[model samples]
Target: MAELWKSLPSWVRNIVVPVLVLVLAWNLVWFVVGVVSSLLGLLIKGLVVVGLAAAVVVLVKKAAKS
Candidate 1:
């Protein structure tokens, strides 16, 4: 394993390492933002559903009494 690592060209290793690191960092940040936005979207949908359900219930009760 050590010999294999040493055999790689120095310039190739240097350029590839930093590029890979930057790509990994960018992917991580993108993943976090996607997760947060997805959760926020779910929360907003839940609130809207709950609000609509409550409104329907209120309207039905009022209609029944009349």
Candidate 2:
């Protein structure tokens, strides 16, 4: 791999490689952000459902006691 790189022209080594790396990094970052946001949204939805269920249960218990 090092030999192949060394054989490439100076312009390719300096400019093209770095540009490709930057593009790859940018895509990787966006992919991570999308995955995390999706998981967080699911978690928030789950919490809301749990909270509503709990509230309903508490209200029903109070009404029964009265």
Candidate 2: Cα lDDT at 52: 100
At residue 9, give the lDDT of candidate 1: 93
TM-score of model 1 relative to the true fold? 0.79
Models 1 onward score TM values of 0.79, 0.84
Candidate 2 yields a Cα-based lDDT of: 1.00
RMSD of each: 1.7, 1.3
For model 2, which pairs clash? none
Best by lDDT: 2
Per residue, candidate 2 scores C-alpha lDDT tens digits across 8-31 of 999999999999999999999999
Stretches off by above 4 angstroms in model 1 are 1-9
